[model samples]
Target: MRTGEGLLGRLAEGGRRPLVVDSSLAALYAAGSLVLGQETPAAPWQPMDALGRVLILLVSAALTVRRVAPVPVLAAVIALWLGYIGCGYWPVVNSPAVLLALYTVAAAHRTRTAAVCAAAVGVTWVVAGLLGGRYTPLPAVAVQAVAFPGVVAFLGRGAGVSAERSRRLAVLTDRLRAEQELRAERAVTEERVRIARELHDVVAHHMSVVSLQAGMASYVVEVDPVTAKGALEAIATTSREALEELRRLLALLRVGPEGEPEGAGEAAPYAPAPGLDRLEELVRRVRAAGVPTELRREGTPFRLPPGMDLCAYRVVQEALTNVLRHAGPAAAVVLVRYAARTLTVRITDDGNRSAPADSPSTGGHGLIGMHERAKIYRGTVSAGPRAGGGFEVELRLPAPHAAGGEPVGRPHP
Candidate 1:
């Protein structure tokens, strides 16, 4: 994002390999001396021979492999340059090549190998100063010998440390970025699943009731006018309730600040959330759809925590809806049990025996959602065909030390 960061990223992406660049630079420097005929002044040392020219080429070439094989490059370049010095030639072109290899060794390899190159450089420098006929005493030449290579080694080691730190930091930054992206994706998935559950409860339940009542009204309009009129009333009530629930769900999904929906149609007022108190309404709807479902409660009822209440209500709603849709002329019974530490729900219906269409074995999303809801309260759910030609769904939720409430109201006939 910043200028320095952008430049570094582009450089890493666009640059040639390190080996290529090193070889090119070393060759350019060598060509200036070897090709142009400007030789370094080594007075007492003899002129360059054919063997010495060959050694110069070898030293230049070895520089290319410094990064890839630092230890081997150091050996080859130093050996060639030492031979060039032994063959009565002055320390000039090949000397710098040896230094380059020493730097590479310190920069790329371990401390032990770099130490070896530094010691060798010091000894070679002292030997050259003493034997080349330069005017210098032993101690003065020794001091000069150790100082230059020791300085070069220290600088190279510092550079190596910096480069290593940069590499580790880059890897850490990339890992953090990947983790952040995963967290975002997980949050989006959770929101999507919650919306799906709301849609099933809001639309599926009411639509089924409307369909059943409308069909009943059409069937008996002439033969039984009184019954037909009541069916029509039920259909009208179901449709209006469905629209209201949809509007409430849409309001819950509004982004950020709350206000009237910005659309051609005005938003509906918010309604209180449904819970066990509205259990009779759910039963009446199921019965209107021609599926006889009875709700039975054992022990005194208790007010559930808001999250637990919503989860339990949705589980019951989904189970009953599945019975009406897939159970084919079966009667369902819902049993709710309250204890000191747990609340249990059991729904059983005498339906077709092979398998219900929305069973877990069929990989239905509805069954999967019921499982998800139960797991939220550290609960468990089991849904499958029963031994006796039907299907059953059982859910248990933890409710430690939950105080009791008044008895639940009775279900409608």
Candidate 2:
């Protein structure tokens, strides 16, 4: 059976094929009829003429196209079978051929077509029995004639429907698998783009600070030793902070199987991300870098969800960095407000000068990164040239009830 299945599989590989499986059964029937005619004196015997021989050959050969052209081949074979009977030929020899054709028709067409074919073939069988001068009782003729043909048709239709359903299920499974693969690929691509954008923001802002400080140290070293030393110290401080941020970014990229970010041949440090608590330190460092910066709180302060805290910190850091790099000699104000529903951070630089060519509002990644970060918490940030001859960046984040609280207080949780 396995070998036969393999052969049919190979046959279907090229295209559709009828593969005359019933022709052998037709030949066996003919041989059995011939043997019975010679040995059994009581057996029904009807000799065939030229027309009957032609009809038998045609009906048996028509089985070859039965699978490919089921309805038409069924019609042709049944017509030939009927003609053969009318010509006074042995009817039993053609029984297998008729059965094969009826099965093929029922398997390929709808139930209506199957019912029509069943009725036509059933009527033909009755007419043939009556014409053959046999003493078949009317009730026996009705039961056997209709029941046999109808049963063959029903079994064939069932098998055909099951095969078709299997085919459709295989196709649907393949399509779903393909769609899943495409979604995975798209997710990977989006993650890569986000990583690239983050690296851009980190390098651009920190390197700008480092560059300005190095230039000041170089120019003042010959005449003002203390001032140049202070500039060198600022550069060292900025570089250290930049390196720490880079480590965090690298850890995010190379997360290990155990949910740990790995870097520097070791597990990432357990240092908490900078948040509102680091605002004073951030401002101190910016002031040391020669950008006058201030931090002010207008309402009761609270801790935030980890992701929201990181977003808030990054937005402030980016905005201050922009002031140092793009706003010439600007004194920036950082304001934090804890409102009923939101935590707002507003940074405004007092420099009336136009922003630099690489400003975030002019097709730069810093603003894009800030926007992306805010989106994570369903928050928003707006930045533009202020009407009062300066630049301002304001961000508002949702202060959910559970996440808004002082570290020591229950705060209505």
- Cα lDDT tens digits for candidate 2, 1-413: 99677556655752542364555755665555455434423435555445555666677667665675677777787777777666656666676777778887888788889888988889877877786537567777778788988899899889889878998999999999999999999999989877786666666667777888888899999999999999898888878887887877777777778877765355565466678888898888778778888888876566688778878887888888788777887899999888767889999998865565346564677777889899988999998888887888999998766454543233331
Candidate 1 residue-wise lDDT, 242-271, digit = tens: 888787777667634446443414544566
Error of 1 at 55 (Å): 3.7
For model 2, give the 10-residue run with minimal summed lDDT.
404-413
Which residue window of length 10 is worst by lDDT in model 1? 404-413
- TM-score each candidate: 0.79, 0.81
Candidate 2 CA-lDDT value: 0.76
C-alpha local distance difference test of each model: 0.75, 0.76
